[model samples]
Target: MLQSSPKGSSSLSDNDNSSDLKSTMNDISSQTNENSDYSILPMDVIVDILSFLILSKQSINEYCNFLQSVHNKNHHSIFNLFFGYKHWDIHKTHVVFLYRNFIVKGDLTPYESRNPSEKVEQDGFIMNYIFKHAHTLTVDYCPMTDTYCQSLRKNKRIERFTFIGNRKHYHSGLCSALRECESLKKLKLDSVYDWEFTKLFELASLTYLKLNTGMMLRDFPPQKYNFDFIVDIEENQGSIKKILKNEFSESRLKHLSLISSEGFTDEYSVSNLMKLPALEILFLENQKITKQSMRTVGQSNLREICFERCLNFSDSGMEQLMKVKLPNLTKLKLSGCGFNTSNLKKVFEPSNGEILNQLTYIELSKNQNMKDTAFSKLGSFKFENLDTVDLNHCVSLSSIGILTFMRSFSECIRTLKLRECNLDETALVTILKSCSKLQRLDLEMNNISCTNIEICEITDLSNLHYLRIEKNNLTDIEWLIALPLSNLQLPRKISNYGTMQLDRQIP
Candidate 1:
């Protein structure tokens, strides 16, 4: 049933040569002593063996020994097929050359060496090869030198680029190199800063952008912090707002993620993001954003939105968001956002529970204030298309609230997570009987006891493929053997019972 592409096709002449190579290999294997001459083998056979060795992640000593017999031209061909720009059409192919590893053991010199001239020559070759053909590249903790930058400018075909570095090293030339990548579509920069954001706007083809400042303010004690750092953060926030408003207004960016950028305050930075017409996915984490900024985000055409650790976002702002009419919204996550049930009800059944009808995925985990009354009100609404619900760490939700919520979406819910919720055995039984179509369920760290009644109820989950009940007070798991589960995770204490039951059922 697997289809082949034109690039994968082999010519008739190549196949005949491969057959001859196979016979030669068989004759060599039958000989008493190993043969060092591999010249009789066809190019396809050598390439196939090398590909197999790399794909299997096995040691290539045998192949390396065989390559010694190959001619220089054939060696270049084999390397091209294995690691060079020969097969650009293969989307899954990626060439990752770590600077530290490359400098120590370049492609030609696979082993370590002490000669400085040889190291320099191999490094040059690696850089040239990557610049000429690599479409995707990831450099780790490597300082971008002037030569590297110049080489990057010539490589306009790079579609994905990731640069990971430390705070001590600053790559000043990265900005200029990025501007030259006209074909770039995705870029991730970590621990890099002070680059002209306006240059990004020139990349009209960019669709995904991620920038992590990598500064953990929490690590430093309050008294040890310098006042200038805070001032610089505020300044960066203003500059980011200006760049977004001026440069990204007409860009074709669809996904934008900003992490640990403390300068991204509510008024200027978040508000400017709303002006991006082509944006659809937005992720904000560890930033200061208020409810007022939510108003601008609600008006945007974003179909997926995630807000994590945005302490300024309160219930009132959520109310404003729920009131907005977003026809295309489908996914929403508010993890670690200390909003209570009253605000959540507004989000679920906002504006008479009519808006966000297309919403299928909802995550309200770590909201300690979500209680029974909230679910009681939530159950009253009709989310006929709801698919996944995550209420993990909502410790205030008791059996009553959980039962009410489960019953509401029992018909359509396919995945449900209630980890660390205050659900008892009765609540677990109710969920089992209600969510008949549930395929994945996570009820870890609860008070549920796996009694006979609970086991009987679990047997009814015919469609369940994954079940996690770890850290619960499960005592009886003998009946778990009857369930048709592809994956199951039970508490450590009850794992012995599960193992014994499986052993008895196996043969």
Candidate 2:
């Protein structure tokens, strides 16, 4: 009878413990239900959160979580809207993610622990999956093995391909695969050698090409042809004529960009470059381009030209360039070319008065020697279609010169950058008053100090959305309080009054 009583007590205790466990689980489930109620959030709020996660750089785990969230919400439509259809397709975004994570960042720790052959196979599988639907691809610092190259050959729809090669590893298979991409239209190769241009030019569908030779030709093997091989020809005319006689003569190539490459110092190279009659855009950066080269470039049917750090290009080079009657030329950029005020006049006011009537954009940044005289002469020229101008770091120009220049181009100017220029309060006011159509203005690092009354002039710029006036001596705060600015950069030394004004006005 005593043993039976003990067993009954044990059963009672077990029952009580079971009841407590069930109660605790019920409380936890209730709390979870309360936390999982994301339905209260508006659709726009959820979309904003997702968009931020997609655009911002995040850890792989975070990205996976975002993808899972996106899947759960069935909000794949946000990707289409976030990355505009014209800029990116759904497949392009996926490829970008793969490239950014695995190639660019070199974050392959998860796969590195695997066996070598297994890792290669896994990488190939992942790459094939991502690139199966991609139309445009850019590869930088990522060496392509034979397996990957063979996979690339299968993508017949790829239109644009950019490869920035690694110096340590040369992948011949990749180049061989590229040669078979009959549908490719645009190709960009950087720091690559041993390429057969004859085969590249054979790509009848190719229209755009960019070649950047970061290392000198002497560093390459004797068998490898430098990108500047065209310029290396002693008889430039004959070489160019030969190319014209070759299959490339009828080639549809239109845009060409050569950067940090050698062999463009002489007239022959220049003449040879100009022989490409179908060329429409030419970009020369860090090249030894002389006056003769500029003349040849100007003779081309090019609609746009960019020259950056072309130290050999002097006033005479600019003069010769302006002399040509390039009716189709509309955009020009001369950054860090060391051209001065004197050269500026030659281009703007050539004796022939053959103005760049179609010109719409001009950039003359980092021309430290440019001063008031240059702008004064520029004002005399007729830039009827001029809309955008960047004169950043042209520190020689003072308030008077800038004021005069702005007043001249006021009617057509829409975007202006005067960063680090010697602009004072008067110049700033003058710009505000004259550039009625100005949409963006940058006056950072200028000597602009305005009184409360003087600052009122800013209100007149109704169309201005971006205004950068940092490092200025602006002491007034009241004028900025009521302005409907979409973007604003204030002076570093904001007074207490200014802080209070901003706090009160911002909300």
Task: List, residue by residue over 1-507, the lDDT tens digit for candidate 2.
Answer: 001122112222333454453343333333333234333444444444343323322222233343345333332322222321221212122333321122222222224524677655545555554344346776655655676677677777777887776654446666677777888899887755544533565677889988676556465543233224333334664543223435456667788777756633343344455556677887888776688765544356778888887877865677787776677888888887887777666666534354455778888888888778875655455557789888899888787877766665788888898988888767766677677777778888888665633555565655676677777776765556555454444446655431221111222
The per-model lDDT (C-alpha) reads: 0.60, 0.59
The TM-scores of all predictions, comma-separated, are 0.70, 0.66
Q: TM-score for model 2? A: 0.66
Cα-lDDT of candidate 2:
0.59
- lDDT per residue as tens, model 1, 1-507: 111224434322333455454444344334312332333454555444333323211122223333444432244432433333211222223333322111211122222336666655545555655654456776655556677778878887788887777665446677677888999999887765553433664688999988676545554333222211111122464553222334445688899877765634343355566557787888887776677775544466888888887767866666777756666678988787777777666655534465545778888888887677765556456676789999999988887888877766888898889999988877766777777887777888888665744455455655776677777776766546555453443444543422221111111
Give the top-scoring candidate (TM-score): 1
- Shift in Å, residue 75, candidate 2: 26
In terms of lDDT, the poorest run of 10 residues in model 1 is 100-109
Query: Relative to the unseen true structure, what is the C-alpha lDDT of residue 53 in candidate 2, on a scale of 0 to 100?
Result: 25
